[model samples]
Target chain A: MTAVESSVATLDPEEARRLRRERLERIGSWVLPLAIMVLAIWLWDRICVWNEIPQYILPRPGVVLQTLYNDAALLFGSLLVTLRITFLGLLLAVVGGVGLAVLFAQSKWVEMSFFPFAIVLQVTPIVAIFPLINIYVDNQTAKLLLCAWIVAFFPILSNTTLGLNSVDRNLRDLFRLNGATRWQELWHLRLPAAMPYFLGGLKIAGGLSLIGAVVAEFVAGASGQSSGLASRIIEAGYRLNAPRLFAALILISLAGIVIFLVLSLVSHLILRRWHESALKQER
Target chain B: MVPSTTVPGMEGSGKPLLSLRAVGKTFSNGVTALSNVDMTIREGDFLSLLGPSGCGKSTALRIIAGLTAPTTGTLDWSRKPGEESSVGFVFQEPTLLPWASVFDNVWLPLRLKGVSRSDAAPAVSQLLERVHLSGFENAVPRELSGGMKMRVSIARALVTKPRVLLMDEPFAALDEITRFKLNNDLLELWQDERFTVVFVTHSVFESVFLSNRIVVMAARPGRVFQEVEVDAPYPRDEAFRTSPAYAALCRQASDVLVSAINSTHGAAA
Candidate 1:
């Protein structure tokens, strides 16, 4: 037999080609929605620019592009500031969320005690709580941290709690019969099994962190001298510099997209090898 | 189980390797899965716990393997005064860890006992060969066929080298051809290993073919209905399966099963 033929003896080329065609078609299906979005954005940008609507009301894509270029240094500095808080808040959320989830999973009393409060936090708007948190913490940075934490904590806590509690009874018994200590069971079985759920929570928390950072920045701008993309947008709007505001908005959108992609990549890389949901193809 | 002829309790004057003293199991949910199940398993004896579903066959096997605590019985095991291991269990489902490769799955019991992978590798590899699964050390459970998965489970059970092997309907889920092949392979493996086997099965023919003795059980507050002794010779083959003696034993076993069914619900047609 030919080398290629022998290598794929169990695999039929015609069938594989058919499957590839189907899979490629499925990937190609994303093209239409992307095209529609691009077309709509471009058309809206053109119409706004043509209408000679006040620049402050709605900046044209070209004007926004110019503003981004002109204010590159200041914009990037603010971008870094926003990213720092977003990432730090995310780190804190994961640590607090997963740690609490482990505790809650281990005890019904802990879950009952804390889960309602977590739900209450989740439901309470971060914007409404920002001023209060600012008062309690007594620092601009601390207030921002508290606000962002409120926004980002719930998803990770809920997802991880579910993950930790949802271990297979058979697997638990297997560990018990094998003479594994409770600590080993948790470190090995509970942790690994909870990973997919934790990653799932992380993906949600990732996006929420960016939103939290932006919102906290907005509230911070409303209160004091600290300024970020939200403040820049507000300042540009007040000054009738629509291009700069558009630039800030564009940056915020980019941040959200970046967080989505980065967390998605992390989740996929960690879980695709074993988990069915993240897996793109069968081995 | 190596060197084949060393019967555990009956071997060379050692105490009985494993014994069940009036074993009974009643679930907290009011299900009496087994009751007053008295059994003495000698070394190298092929004993089948034969019964229908809910007959406590699996329950009995589980109790022997120490996977489940009997509600009203004590297990007597003499581990040669120094042997730490007592019994090994092969579950009905292949129960191979989906994430671990075949070698790793088989190495679990040994690994749990503080044996390094390298130290356990030779023993695990030898076990793979014993189960006719060489060169498949790296294959995962998802990569294996049903029969192959069951073989891996069997291999995992045998890796610890326990005196008694408790198999709970290990081949019940396999296709007829695969089941027959595995049955013969199991007997061959048993011959080589010489561990006392407590095999659970629902098939009359299978029990007749494999076991030195078959304990038939009745369901619903499960209890032993009767015991049948097979006087068949060793090294039984396909010819033996088709033999008049085997058919007669099967018929006798079936009669006992029907009688038990009749005693229970008058459903033994």
Candidate 2:
């Protein structure tokens, strides 16, 4: 019996088949999307070349790439500026959102009085508010940061509040039975349980923060040393430099994707060991 | 058959650790969960509050732990005022913190008492070993089975070495084999520690096998209906479980529970 088991274990056909399938699926996930993207780009270039499209109207993919390469210094500098705004706005939003959420969890009256204001901020379009903000705020960077922070703050606040309130009643009773102080309960029980919800909100806020930064920049139309990728897009549009415009757009889209990916990775790393959402479902 | 008794502080010859005098609870929504609950918990006694659902067994346990306040009664504690920390509670569910490792979950009560992790590690380790979870110290609650999670919960409750341990249907979610194993282990722990235990359960056989005295309760303004004494010798093993005495005690308790449950139905009708 032992000899038979050992021989079967060495050449397990079912195990081998499953491993091969898993490997193929893993490779196909990224490889397939990449191949499709390359093919689409090639087709786009072919169509532009075949039709003799004007560079001002519809530049070829190669021209767009060339424009990106030639203006790397200026474009990359603007990219850094845009990314800085995105990060800074997201940081401020997290601080404000989580801090307010803790206060809301502590007192109902505070939440009732201030939550409607936060809702008004979220629902009121940033574009509509930009002219008013620009009129009052002379510092272009601070105005952009405020707009971005407003856009990103609500999800974190709502999600964190829900997470804090959704604690298991049994666990809360246990904490009370142990004679835990209010601060201790909040710090130990509420905070750890709210982490996954906070991280989920962070991932969403990452994209919104970038959008907020770019939209605010476009509205401001600021040019010169402080200009971001959005401003580059506007400048390229005025000159009818379609390739450069495309390049700037691509850089903004890529930055948004990177932010989303980084936030997701952070969430996964923190929750992988314990949370139900992070656990792999077995058939 | 054991006679039904209503007089408080009548059972158990042991010295009283805590006495509940006319305890009652009425929620804000006007639901009376418990009413005129009078009982005396004696030191080193394994007392089971066996009742049907909605009999306020859990509420009674919670009130004892000071997690909930009684509406109309006094809970007089025999222990010193500063010894309020010497009470541990286990809920119906395992209630282990999913984020923490088994060691950390067991270390929580001690940590709350201002003991550092390093100082609490020895007690946590000893309790984990007692619960047969020695090698699973670093394992998260998610990694454990239902029974194992309950074991961790038990370990955490015992880590503080509380004089009174209140458990509310702690093994209700587990399978029969696991529940039986846990019951035996709990008895062993009780034998060794001699802590005053107020166990709440709905199972007659379980109460019969584990407790020296079982308090049968009724619902609809929950109150005590009867008290049954097992009068069985301790160091009970598989032989005791299979004995005629165990079966007889279970039969008596089952009869009391049935009548208690039926009385509520009769009153409603």
lDDT of 1 by residue, A227-283 (tens): 777778777767888888889888989998989999999888876545778756744
Off by over 4 Å in 1: A1-27, A281-283, B1-15, B266-269
Q: Write the per-residue lDDT of candidate 1 for residues B222-260, one digit (tens) a residue.
A: 777777777677788899999999999999999988776
- Model 2, B47-95: lDDT tens digits are 9999999999999998999988999999988987677637888888999
Task: For every candidate, give the share of true A-B contacts it also has.
Answer: 0.18, 0.76
Please give the range of 10 consecutive residues that has the lowest summed lDDT in model 1 chain B.
B1-10
Tell me how many residue pairs clash in candidate 2: 0
Cα lDDT of model 2 by residue, A1-283, tens digit: 9998897799679987988899999999999999999999999989898998899999998989999999999999999999999999999999998998999999889889999999999999999998899889889889999999999999999999889888999889888888899999998899999999999999999999999999999998753425899999999999999999999999999999999999999999999999989999876
DockQ of each: 0.34, 0.78
B216: Cα error in model 1, Å: 0.7
Residue B164 miss distance in model 2 (angstroms): 1.0
Is model 2 an incorrect, acceptable, medium or high docking prediction?
medium
